[model samples]
Target: MADSSCGPRPLPPDDLALLSGLQPHDVRKVAESKIQAYRAMIEDINGYIIQLSTIQNTTVPLHASLPPEILMHVFRHILPTGPSDLRLTHVCKLWRDLIFRTPEFWVDMLAISAVTAHLDHNTDSPLSFPSFVVRSSPLPFELDLHRGALDFLRTIPSHVSRIHSLSLHLPLGSDYAAYLTALFNLDMPLLETMRCSTYATAWPIGLTDSTTHRVPDGQKFPRLRKLAFCGPGLPTRAFAFPSLRELKFDDGMFSEPLGPLMDFLESCAQLEVLEMNIQSPARQFRTERDAVSLPHLKIFSLLLDAPEGLWAYDFLEQVIVPATAQMNITWLAGSDHPLRYLIPTSPLSLSVEAIQVIHTLTIRFNYDRTVRDDSKWILSVNGFVPSHSQPYLKLTIHCPCWTLEEDVRPSDALSDLSGLFTCAPSLQKVKLRLDHGITVTPDHWFVILNSFPSLSSLTVRIGSCRSLLTVLRRNPTRWPALRRLSISCRNGSGVHECLLSAIERRAREGSRLEYIAFSGSPRRRLSEHRMRRLEGLVDEVTTVNEVEFCGMH
Candidate 1:
């Protein structure tokens, strides 16, 4: 291609070739001189063109032309992880100046990429995390401190008033007990969300729920909303979290009674989301305590290392939650009895005693941002209310990436679940996952879908698109109430085109698939051309990733 930016071609001033043709020697010599002059001019033009190109290449846009605040907002989105924000300064001197001058960016948030940089043994020229904290002066702080970053303990006394969100990872052998004792003593008026994890070999990892480790008596966390205590520590008592909305206690073995746990729950009046993974001793929360009612609780999930579901039943029975609230209970693989119980007919119609027995098993699917997260799940509905609502009674089994042992099938246990369908007359909306390595076949899924006459919606995960399409094609009366057909597939599997043809054929036959949602890995999703064609075939077609959230958080 021609360089359009280059100036127009330079021309010789005189036509010396014609004079050379008329007079042989003298005119030819004069033509040669004219050619030499033209060559020199051409060289100059080439050099000038190179100079122009250099100028164009050197010109840079630091996004300074756009509003700085808007650009900063974009940068924040680029790396929500926060500490990675400092990398922006290395882009250019302008960006460096802008980032350094922006106190808001530095003040409330500081992420030192490596914690041990300041240690004498780690580096001679240490990268000071405190320097960033200092620059972020007069602004509320959000810190991400990892293991070996205990130097942050030194800065906390001075900046205690400014700390807003703090995530600390205390090393196992270190004296974190004292460090935390000093930490909770400080006045943190602006602190809201705090997560503390430690490797110490104590009953509680970092700060226990005990008042001994809590902030000074007068200092309370009025604005504190979220607390994720993710180590061995269990909050002993209510530590005054007035505004606590979400509390996550993950991976801990509490060696205390249920009284303090109940008290902590009672303290958070505004608590909406609670996730805990604590292992109860053999005794469990069976101390004959009074029921604690949670009015505002929307999502309650428990990940336990307990032996049986009865432990959960005992605890959940005491804590009264709304009927609509979603509860997810997961425990260490012990007895499969809880997940395998057979409800007589309608769970809603069952006696209270029978319901208590059923409650031993977990209830409700874990509501995730996206279904693509790679968590192994065994979903079963105990029974259903006879409401016209879509989600009533139908068992939802999401086995995205099931664990296999010694060449064992993904879920032989689920195969035995075919008996449960005999009791599900009101069941509707069956969504099943199948992909790269699952043992469940399309034929098995087809049989299940065919069994339910009341099945209104059908969703299938297609690792190999042809098999499921073949299944749908084989059964003419697959689902009478089937209005929605959702396909979860890997992108480049050529599934979209096959899906369009199959669903279109179904539409022609009268069971018009009202909605078709196609979801898969982003890289393998259908190209725009295929997506447009698929859209035309169905009334509504949605493209999505299969294990969406399973990948991100």
Candidate 2:
């Protein structure tokens, strides 16, 4: 037979002679091996057909056939990050074309990285950081970079007017005060928000000093609404922005007179929010009868360092914050002035003492996260004064948190807080945190509960229900008004027994609780029999497998 008889190239004549000499079984084996190889080739060809069919069958993976307009829109949503975003340009020639065509993507390059090893880095090149920004000219964009990267700004001075939001951070431990000083000399008509923070290493000896000569009215950023200039040794110039609405100055600014600081603030008439970390003035603040009054200001946060209470009070007296404004002032740690006396008496008549009643009084004792000391505790007495006439006052006294007695909670911390509860004599609801090391014993709990005589509802997480059981077994513990109880049922079945015994004792005293709620202990949620037993003791009983309660308020 010919070599092509089987529709495959026949073996060579020498190979054919060898195969003819082989046994019939050997020939069958060779044919079977060729058949298997042909089958694998057929399967591979079918796989391509199936994938092609799937591509024709599905409408998903929209990018596979995306229109140019839709692709552009998709590219527009990607925030311009550094190297990570630049890597996307190399995916294909189409992406590179899109990235260059949409110049907006390159507008927000923060090129002032301290560690980026762009040894080829410079603003002078055509495809460098400066070029990317230049491509976005005539369009409003954001500029956020370290002060060292001001060359990027110099490279695109023509596009400076189009910048909308500019944030310049001073390089760490570096002096670029001269660059920051010259920045104010430019015109930015479209700028809305400017955040400039740096430690000014040296003061500028300019043609006109800030202390003596104010920046001429409307000199820069005519449309600016927000300005935050922070850190010590800041520029001594007064900024005059007609449209300024928000201003924040941190306390690092030093050796400047209060008059200059106030003078700078007086220039902005439309400010609605002012946050300042009050520092000791260079000179004493002379009482001025004609102080600036912020009529539209809504929020004033003052952070005062030590030995600044007198300054704080003087500042409060000088400025007239409107009745509607909210004030938060953190003074020296050991401030002797009470919170009630510290707040300026306002036309709104909103005072700490006005909190007559609270819906929930939550007292939690936990490790203070803010303080580094592990031995100390943070006791938060949280409550919200329920009202709608104006902003409701939230009264929270961090008592045991401030006490120096680290090992044991000070008795005075809780006892002294009688004044707080007394202020809200009609307080009805209460939640007590007792999971941590609560120094208050069963008798101590009674005094605290008795303090809030009108408390009709109570939720407690105790070391064990044992202390609470002790309280309920007694005469005074039979709270005449405490109708609802929420207890954390942890520890063991002894907790349930403690609860049942307390309920039975209360019932015997003819002062049974109207409702009882149990929470925590997932697997051991009360069985139906136990719940029914509890139902007989109280008007109603409810159990939850797992429960979590938030802060006191």
Candidate 3:
């Protein structure tokens, strides 16, 4: 009989006959198997739901808390370009509204061909800049307009009037008169600096006419301090600026006579610094013995490519003696030969005290060919060295040569150097360069180094390392006061190690060696371990607490 406590009894397919045929164990096994399969199916469904919920939590967008105004300021500092920066406005309504209204972001404009290539090809007017620049902030600003944008700038009266610093580079043969006329008329009362480089064909002839209308009389740039003109065929007529302190004329083709240029300088009485490089081969200047002097001129640099035999020194002497007697003068002449003869020796004696007052003197002797031995040349240089009455002198000598064969070795050329050192007993620092392929014997090196007893720092550049080490071993005492030593040679690996060992040996014996630099070409495929070992020995020296090993090609 079936148990009634089991709730309800199952119906048999063939009633009692089928039930009698089946065993109780088989029925129990089938029922248990079915239960296990349904349990596993439910677990899989639950796991899938959990995975979907986790993905939703991680992939959702999060809103930023920064204010729109601060974000716009950040954007203003970046040069405007790139899809990422442009699409930033589309991220939200707040960003779009803030960026569109901030005109300060557009005040300082720079339009270049590389950046505006797409705009240049699509429009009839390549320079139709986005209107934001035309209606920007009220603050004085800078405008850098390059390539073919000068024509577009002429139409923007508002932009021109507010520019405090303007840089324009226009093509050759463009009508720059309209642009200049606009600049001359613009009421940029606060404009302080202007740099313009224009290349134009047909030469701006109208700009050269001295009789053309001038900058309004009595109008002065009270705050303007600097002006630079880098253009071809610039008019030489005088322009007035009473408050200008620095003036630079670079690569300008002079059209008018020197009289007008001199007049322009005289007008700027407050001018302190003047740099002019005249490129016109045909331009000539008439010397005015009674021309106005530059009373306030502190620094003057004139670069000219005149006839070799031209009496440029006469003009320079005239300018120097009266106008700027108290000024520290720096004269650079680009000539085929040395101009040591042209430099007046008589003036040296007259102004020896005044010239000695100059804190720094730089003489750049540019020679195309080998400098032939000139006795007068040596005497001229020696004359400039102040007498012992002046304070100690700091000297720097730089000679970049292709080969040492052309250089006059100190041993062979010690007479001039001896005279120079004797004239100035206060010499403190000396630098000597012997270019590649030039060899100096150990004996000659010793003689040269010993000449400057007061030098605290010495740099010797040689072509061969073996030769340099031989020299150092011979006379280490000559460099007792040297706190810094710099050596450049060809074979550096073994030489560097030897130098380090020698310096250490000296330091252990009580020598002051503070700094050492070994510059040379390294051995092929040297490992870092080897390099470090070489560096460590030099570092261990007493006077040299720090050492540098560089591998230069």
**lDDT tens string, model 2, 1-553?**
5566668875568556656866899988876876797799999999988667555534346646786577777776777655666777776556666776776666544332421335233646645656666666656877666645566566667888888888777542323335445676678889899887765554344312345545445556788888887775332344556678888887564554455556656666577988877564433454563666777887776766543334555676667666456555555342333333344333333323323534556665565556655333434555544553333222223333342323324333454443446446657887777544455567656667666778788887764566666777665344678788887746535577667777887787777789887775565666677788889888887765434433222
Error of 2 at 258 (Å): 6.7
Q: Model 3: which residue pairs collide?
A: 172-199, 172-200, 172-201, 173-200, 173-201, 513-543, 513-544, 514-543
Query: What is the lDDT, from 0 to 100, of the residue 521 in candidate 2?
Result: 58
Instruction: Compare the candidates by TM-score and give the number of the best one.
Output: 2
| Ten contiguous residues with the weakest lDDT in model 2 | 392-401
Candidate 2 lDDT score relative to the true structure: 0.60
| Candidate 2, superposed: residue stretches over 4 Å from native | 1-78, 84-98, 110-124, 148-157, 169-185, 200-222, 233-242, 245-249, 253-361, 368-376, 380-428, 441-456, 464-553
RMSD in Å for all candidates = 20.5, 15.9, 20.5
For residues 349-463, write the lDDT of model 1, one tens digit per residue. 3212222222111122332435544344444444333332322222333441133322224334344344345345545655554435444566655655554567667665545
Q: Pick by lDDT: which candidate is best? A: 2
Q: Is candidate 2 or candidate 3 better by TM-score?
A: 2
lDDT of 2 at 58: 40
Q: TM-score of every model?
A: 0.48, 0.56, 0.49
